[model samples]
Structure formats: C-alpha cells, structure tokens
Target: MKKRLSLALLPVLMPLLHACTTVGPDYHVPAHAAVHAPQANGPLLGTKHPAVSLAPVPDAWWRLYDDPKLDKLVRESLTANTDLRVAAANLRRAIAMYHEVEADNLPQASVSAATARTQISGESFLMKEKIPVFSIGDVGFSVSYLVDFFGKLERADEAALASAEASQAALDMARVGVVAETVRAYVQGCAATHEYEVAERQLALQERGVDIARKMVAAGRGQPVDALRAQAQAETLRASLPHFKAEQEKAAYRLAVMLGKPPAALPAAEAECHEEPRLRQAIPVGDGAALLKRRPDVRQAERELASATAKIGVATADLYPSVSIGASAGLTGLLSDLGTGQTAHWALGPMLTWNLPTNGVRPRIHRMEAGADAALANFDGVVHKALQETQSALSAYTKELERNLALRAARDNASEAARQNRLLYQAGRAPYLSSLDADRTLAGSDAAVAASDSEVAIDQINLFLALGGGWQNSPDVTK
Candidate 1:
C-alpha cells in the first residue's frame, strides 16, 4: 500500500521537479549596437577645439557661468515644474505595476464562508418520507501555486522590472529638459535686454545727429534736406526699439512660466539684466562613452529594449503547458452538524492546462519576436541620435564663436569710421550726408554685434543641453 501511494503521487511531483526547466530565450545585449564600437570609447569628434575641455562634464553644468540668479532659477524650476510632476507620477505608477506583477510569484490563497436554508424533496429519494427544510453552512480555505515549469511568471517579473526602470529613465530625461529650458529662458531674457539697451543708445545718437543737422541748416551752413534725412534715420531707429522691448518682455514671460509663476510676477531685477551670462573657462565635454552613459534618452531606450526582450520570453512560454498545485480544506453540512468530523472534507492535487498548439500560440510568439526586433532598431537609433545631436551642437557653437569675433571687429571698424567722418564734417571738410551715412553704418554694425552675442549665448546653452549633464544632480521624485 505504501508503494501504491508513492506511485500515485508521482504524477504531481514530476511537474514540481521539472520546475527548473525554463522556456524561451534569455536576454543579452545585442552585440551590434552602436555603443560597443571602439570609437565610442574615445573623445567625441567635435571636441578638438580651444573653447572646450576634454574633462568629464560636471553634474550641474550651468554653474560654469557663475550666475547666481541662473542657478537659483534652475533649482526652483526643478522643484516646481508641472511637467516634472507628471513624470514623477508616471514613475510611481510604473513601480506599482511592477509590484503587482511580482506578487504573482507567491502562492494565492482565499477563504470563504456561507450559510443558507434549503429543502429536500421526498420524491427525489423515492421514499414516503418527507424531507424538512434545513440550514446549510460551509467554510472553506484554498491555496494555489502555479508551478513555473515554463518560467512564464519569471519572464513577467523581468518585463515589469524593466518597464519600471524605463519609467525612471524617462523621469530623468524630463529633468534634463526642464533644466535646459529654464536656463534657456533666463539667457534669452538677459540677451534681449542687452539688445534693447544697444538699440536705445543708437536711437539717442541718431536723435542728437538730427538736432545738429537742424542747427547747421538754421545757421546757413547745411541743407534742409540734410536735417530731413537725419530726422528720417532717427525715426527708423526709434521704430526698432519697440521690437527689442517686446522681445525682452516675451523672454521674461517665458522665464516666469518656467519658474511656475505668473508672467507678471517676474522680478524687476531679472528683467533689468543687461549683461548675458558668459563662461570664463572652456566648457568641459566628456567623450562618446560618457555621453552614452549620461544621456537619459539612451538609458530609456536600453531599458525599453530589455522590457521588450522579456516580453518575448513571456509570450514564448505560452507554447507549453501550465501547471498549478492546489490544496483545499472545508466543512459543509447541515447547520446542526457543522464542524463535526462527518462534515469535514479536504483535497490536494496538481492541475495541468495547455492551450494546445492549434490555439494560436505560435502567432503570439512571432508577434513578440517582431516586437523585440523593433526595440533593437529603436535602441540603435537613439544611440546614433545622441551622438549626432552632441556633435552638431559642438559644431554650431564653435562656428558661432568665430562669427561673433568677426562681428565685434566689424563693429569696431565702423565706430572708428563714424568718428573720423564726424570730425571731418565739423571741420567743414566732409558733407553732412557723409557723416550721416557713417553713423547709420555704425548703428547697423552695433545691432549686428548685439544679435550675435545673443546667438552665442544660445549656442552655448544648446551644447550643454546636448551633453546631458544637468539631470545628474536632479532631486529624486520617487521618494
């Protein structure tokens, strides 16, 4: 009898013993991905310039400008930005979903209790005895554990964990974006104010020229047309003032919004800024290897690929049979006999369920394989894009710095020419029109220089953004 009982239990024990046989392919990083190339281990192609250093980028790159106001605004935006709050909530949700999937690895249990009145018919028993109404009571407890003989639950856990990590990376990306944009708005506001001041100075010079031209005409030393020409130039310069003023106001409004405040709430000191922030030292930009590690978009894509790979395993596990072991104990009888030995019952067994091959399991496996292929492609694309953006930003900044140098020189030459022409006119050796023309050229040159200054500041900010340094020191939103 013992031998017979042992044989009887073999069927149930066999599946548990085979629980180590996990189905589907395990995940490995694709060898052909761009991050593995030898070039990625060295300095970036665009870093061979005097304006940038080969040192590792700092976490808070904005501090290189040494602008206390910019640093304060970045910190405030990180804490209060609405987009960051949404990203934080998404991360929390993904973590909760992972926990929900992870719980499936443990046994499931349930308890039930019920009481009801019931009647038995005499005809059903084929006897002349009448059955009286009675009260029935039942209490049950059951536990079931899915024997992961094919690793379905294990794959599910992996996929969920990867998804949670991807969400975390996404939050990091958001922080990077918020920090970059906050810095951008601040720089733009200051740059616009500088341009406005430059334009105002030009307008004042032109107005003074108009007064001198009128005085010369009254003293019979200059033509009425010269005064008219000077007046027209002055009006033209005055007209440009509003546009610069509008740009300053627009930038201030953007900065205010980025800080999570009303547009009108912008500080007077912030709007009064006339000097754009500039870096005193070369910007530190690490290499491609570091960029791959630092950029949150790259991390997010890699995590997504991991999640998709695990999902393929989950789908592949569906091709095999699923096994679950369940045990239950209960008491069910008339209320008067409840809890007695005669009413007690218990059962234990292993259950097997298979979705047969004809039930569309192969197609699901194919779908998952296709999804993994797509994820691999996306990972490659993201890596390439990171490299491209960083290199492009570096090129733009270097070229703009060169352009700014030329503009400053041109402004200086125009200033000298305007001074010489004014001296000649005062000595009665040059026409009023000649001096007037020189002054206009000088005004144009100064405006060009001002605009170039703004562009250079913007380009520097773009390069920092592409380097992806700001998110490293960001506050953890998950806590």
Candidate 2:
C-alpha cells in the first residue's frame, strides 16, 4: 500500500521538477565595460618612452629597486598592516555568508524528542467525568528538501558567491595600497635625508664664504656690507635644514606605523639612508588589456555588478510559490505504551507556500533592477578611473624625467661657473661679490636637483601603484 501511494505521487512531482526555470535576466559582461579598453589593446598613451617598457608588470614591483630593507619593510607591512587585517576579516565574513546561502541547496534534516504530561476530559456524553494526567513521550526525525522550482535558492547562491568574490578583490586592493605606501614612506625618508646632507654641505660652503668676507674686511680690502650679505645668505641656508629633518622624521614615523609599530619606534637604518633607491631599468607597464584585467578595483566593480544582477533574480523569485518535499515518522503515546506499533505514525508529502500579498514584490524587483543599473555604472566608472590613473602617472613620470634631466644639466653648469669664479677671485681678476653670486647660484641649483630627484622617486612609486602590481601573490586571508 505504501509503495503504491509513493508511486502515485511521482507523476504529480515530475512535472513541477521539469518546469523549473530561473526567472531573472541572465548576467553578461556589460558592453560598455570592454568599450573603455584602448583601441587594439595597444600600449597606454604614456608608455611611448625609453623609461617605460611594454613588458608585463612585476607582481612584486618594490623589489625592482633591489633594496633589502625596503623588501623587508614591504613584507612586514603586507602581513601586519591594520587596513589589510580589516579587509581580511571582511573577506572571511563574506565567504562564510556565501557558504550559508550555498547550504540551502542541500537537504535540511532535524531530530526532535519530547516528554509531556497530558490530560483527557470527557463531557459531551451528558455526564461530567474527571480525567487523570499521564506522561506522554514523543520522538521524531524529519527531512525536507526545497524543490527550487523557480531557482530562488540558486539565484541567492549566485549573489552570495559574487559578493564573496568582491570581498576578495577588496582585500587585494588593500594589499596593493599597503605595499605602495610602505615603499613611498621608505623612499621619501631616504630622499629627505639626502636633501639634508646636501643642504649641510651648502651651508658649510656659505659659512666659509662669510669667513672670507670677514677676513677681507679686516684686511681693509672689502666692505663691511659684504660680510653682512654673506652672513645673511648663510642664515637663509641654515633655515632650510630643519624642514628636511622634519620630512625625514615624519616619513620614518609613518613607516613605523605602517609596519604595525608605534610612531616612536622608528626604523633607524632607513632614516640614516642618504640615497633613495632607484630602478635600474625601464618600468614594465603592460598594455591596456592587461591593466584592465589586473586592477583590483575594476575586478571589484565587476563582481559587484554581478552580485546586483543576481539579486534581481532573487527578488523575482519571491513572486512565485515555494515548494518543498517533506517526510517524517514518529512514535507518540502514553509512557506505558510509547514503543507499541499502535502508537506509530508516518507522513510524506509536498508543502506549498505562497505569499499571497505580493503587491510589494514588483516594487522590490524594480529596486533591484535600479541597483543593478547603478552597479553597472559604477563598474564603468572604475574601469575608466583605473585607466586615467595609469595614464596620468605615466605622463607625470615621463615629464618629471625630462625636468630632472634639465635640472641636472643646470646643476653641472652652475658647478662649473662657481669653480671658474672662485679661480678668478683667487687670481684677483674677479670681484669677491661676483664669486659669491656664483656660489649662491650653485647652492640653489644643488637644492633644486635634490628636490627634483625626490619628485622622480615619488612619481615612479605612484606609477607602480597605478599599474596595480604587488597584490598578485598576496596572502590568502580567508583561510
């Protein structure tokens, strides 16, 4: 009899199973996203220079400088930076949420046991009768499986998976940021130290000039005003030393914090470095196609769009009825007869749930559609922003390279002019004031060169950051 009953239900269930259809618009990569990639996937506009190569960008770009201290600092920051830690935590949470939604596709089972005292009363026979209470025991096991006749759970799983991917991308983005910032801090500290050294040398030269002016005045061969002018120049140069020192200290403090140390726990060796690290070869900047694929922000935006699109299906699924197959067998009786066959019972069937008041469902679907639209727009914006940043960084780096070359040439010319003026002064063929002017020009030129060098180093780091390297091998925090 039970077999016949089960056979009778199969025909009714088969049709519902075969009719399952996912109810929302399917997701595809938006057409506008690929449109933003440069034509022919050619080299970026700013990459047509000797300083930039079309080779693939390095995953660990900071190592290009071959500075052991910088390498160690970047490694430490990647592991210990607080921002990365937070992002890792978020990724873990997202993964867990995805798993939770994924579980809906499997059978849900539950076991329950209970004991209660019950009383029976009889009063409808026209005679009142007292009833005794007795203990009852019940034990049951049940399982239910959602039919997913409308692909509701499937869409939920899709949305959750996309969200998890977005979280992973966000973590990657954070890794890139931490690495770039660590390199920037180290480079800036070293550059400031170099500037400080240059200024100290220039101040020493100026002090000697002041001494020479004083000596000439004492010998009644130079005016007192000449000594005063020389003294004033030396004081001005002395004023700049503190600014460079402050810059070095600030960079050190920033670096220490990034390494998960206190601000006062400065990296002493890094602070003492007087030369900023430089790359020995052209920067490897792959074409636009690779950049679009490599950038984490772009990936994040794309995943968010996918998630939003899935949510539309989720909302649409709400408009239909939910169906599930349920089965249970249990024994229920007085304590004295709980295990008897007479107390056995069983039930097997399908359950249908329909939220009849669906006036709000369509509105929710519209809202989800709007959200997807916004996500699509955001994705396009992120792609364009990534390209813009890369192009701008490349342009700035190349222009700074040109400017640096000009400044270096000016520095060399000023150095030669100062040397000639000093020789002429010693031979009594040039006035002391003329020599002083040449020395001042040389000092100014040296400072300008130092400042320009720092700018170039900073620009290189920025370009690498825009290239979105250094996160390819980021640690798996979700584990």
Candidate 3:
C-alpha cells in the first residue's frame, strides 16, 4: 500500500516542480554610469531659520519665507490649478490599470443562456426541411487559465505596477513645475512695480528741466532746443510708465488667481522691501542617493524600464510549447419517434499548442528588448539632467548673489555722484550739462539695481525647481 501511494504521488509532484520556471526574464536593476554627480557642494550661509533645525527637507519649504500672504496664495494654487487636476486624474487611471492587471491572478467565470427558433423551406437542402424548430439553452461554469506555470501572469502584473508608480511620479514633477511658476510670476510683478516708480521719479526730474528752460528763454539765457530735449526725455519716461504698470498689474492679477481669489482683490503693499521675498537660504544639498529617490520623473523612468523588462519575459514565454488538458461534461437531449434520451459527453487529454518563436514572435521580443533599452537610457538621461540642473543653479545663484552686491555698490556710487554734482552746480562751479549727465547716470544705475534684484530672486526660484523640492515640501497648488 505504501509503494502504491508513493507511485501515485510521484507523477503529480513532478509537474509541480517544473512549474516554477518563469517565462521571459526576471528583472534585475540595470547598472548605470553615474555622470557629473553633485558632491552636494555648499557652505552654510548664515543662521539657519528657526523653523529649520537639522535640515529634514521641510514640508512647505516655500512657506519658510515667513510671508503669511505668500503662504496663503501658494496653498490656494495647489487646490485650484487645472493642470494639477489633470496630473492627478492620470494617477488615478494608472492605479485602476494596475488593479485590472492584478485581477488576472484569479479565475474569471461568466454565465450565458440562449434560445433560438428557425424555419427551413422545402427547397433548402430538401432532407434538412423535415427537421422541426428547436430551442437550445446552456447553463454551466468553465474557467480557462494559462496556469501561470512560469510566472507569466505575475510578470505582467509587475509591469502594470511599475506603470502606476511612474504615473504617480509624473504628478510630482507637475507639482514642482507649477508652484515654481507661481512664485516667479508674483516676484516679477513686485519688481515691475519698483521699475514703474523709478520711471515716475525720472519723469519728475525731466519736468524740472522743462520749467528751467522756460524761465531761461524768458530771460534770454537758454535756447528752445533745451526745452525740446527736456520735453522728449519726460515723454520717454512717460511712455515707459504704461508698460511697467501693465506688467505689474498682470503679475498682481496672476498672483491673485493663483491664490484662488479674484484678480481685483489683492491687498495693498505696505513697503517695497517687505514685499521683496528672501527664500530660506543655505540650501542643503542632500545625499546623492536621496536626491535620486526624491526625483519623480527619474523614478517614473526607472519604473518604465522595469515594466519593459517584464515584457521581455512575456515575449519569451511565446517561444515554448504550451500543454493543457481539457475536459467537457454536459447533458444532451434527443427525441426519436416517441422516445427521449439524456446523455453525458466528455473528452480528456493533453492539448499541445506549438509554434516557433522565431517566426511571428521574434520581432515582438526584439521590440520589447528595444523598448527596455530606451527606457534605461531615459532613466539615465533624467538623472543626468537633474544633476546638471542642480549644479548650474548653484553656480547661477552664487553669481547672482555677487551681482546683487555689485549692483548695490553701483547704485550708491551713482546716487552720490548725482547729489554731489548738483550741489557743486548750486555752488556755481559745475555746469548744467554736468548736472544733466549725473542725473541720467543715477537714474540708469537705479534701474540696473532694480533689474538685478529681480534676477537674483528669479535665480532662487530656479534653484528650487532644479532640486525638485516642491513635492518634498508639499507645495501649494497653482491656481
């Protein structure tokens, strides 16, 4: 009895052992050559913010600027932006697709029933015309399975899972891009306001020359050309007035919309310096591994690579012959003369499906491999671009910092030069031409300083984008 039991179990266990063979290929992370990776270079600039202690990559990093209005606006944008909504929708779709793929693990069964009636003419195959109409119905359960004998189904599931992960990461990238844009637009608007004020002051100075020329002409001490030149200068400044006002208003409206508010409802600015935001500085460059992990687009690329790898297995499974056993058991009713009979029918045997993979399947397998290769390259590209951006941003920020200092010095020098030249002219030693030259120099220098301030702020925004830090910080939506 023991021998017979062992003999009976041997055949059953034999197939089960071989069933472990996974089709196509099991994935391994592809090796990549790291290029121009950041050494996380930076010096701690000044005292760290009180809110930030050991640099844990704070949530809402933009809010660290300590501006309540800005904080509110960013939060509003996060909730209202249509582009963000689209990204989120895509994420949900990916999740559904993954779920659909996962459902393949279980048997799928459905039920059906049918009834039909038909009439045949005598001319229609004469012998068949004698048959009467009939009603046919079937009620049964059948489950067809590929058996996952080689983990083929599971590999497909893995591919779907990777796709879902990629979608989620894409949403992160979108989040980073939009908030950076919002912050930038707001800063530009504020800077434009400053430029407009400068134009106004210059226009006032030009008006003074117009008045002086009128008096000099009445006393016969100045030419008409002098008054004409003064008028032209004043008009030039006036012409610029509309442009700056338009730009500032545009920025303000954009900001209001981003904050999920009506464009007409922005609060008045108290002080220009107070409106000029200085983001939390001493930007910490975290670990390379962590940086890679934090980047959504990079992760999405890697996930696509994984999905492609699994496809290689799915394709390879086609190369081998598939053997399946099938059986059908049902009831049939027949009526002959006055008799009715019910019978059972069934068939059982190994069914073999065979075809050479090299024929129709080889091209597909090659395609899958090619796709995987492309995905790997894309992954590498994203990593390289990310690193490059951070490096470039750091260099840019450093330069802008230096540029701001130089512009400040230039502004001071030009301002003092104009004041001194005017004083000397009042003391009757400097000519009117010298005073005019000094005024023009000071005005241009002030404009340059204002422009440089905007550049510095813009560079700071770029750094945030390069680092892909918005997601880490839970950035507010861009309305």
Q: Which candidate gets the maximum lDDT versus the true structure? A: 2
**Local accuracy of candidate 2 as per-residue lDDT tens digits, 1-479:** 66576667678668778888998988888765653555625679967799999999999998899988889899888888888889999999999999999999999999989999877665644558766788999989899999888888988998999999999999999999999999999899999999999999999999998998899889887789889988999999999999999999899998988888898776487546789898989999999889988999999999999999999999998888788888999999887898899989888877767775456988999999999999999998887788889999999999999999999999999999999997887676888889889999999999999999999999999999999999997766555
Model 2, global lDDT: 0.89
Candidate 3 residue-wise lDDT, 1-479, digit = tens? 54465456557646755766887767766544342334422322221323112354444667756777666666667777666888888888988988998887765554444334555565677574466665443433344444566676778898899888888788888777777877877777777877888778877876886687667657676567766766776787789889988888788777766655677766756112223587665655454565666667877888888899998887777776654433444434332211223444433333446688658788988999999988888877888787778667767777777777898898899889988976775565766567667777877887788778788778877866776767754643322
How many clashing pairs per prediction, in order?
Answer: 0, 0, 8
Model 2 pairs in collision: none
Candidate ordering by TM-score (highest first): 1, 2, 3
Task: Give the Cα lDDT of each candidate.
Answer: 0.88, 0.89, 0.68
**What TM-score would every model get versus the actual structure?**
0.94, 0.93, 0.82
Q: Which of candidates 1 and 2 is the stronger one according to lDDT?
A: 2
The weakest ten consecutive residues by lDDT in model 1 span: 1-10
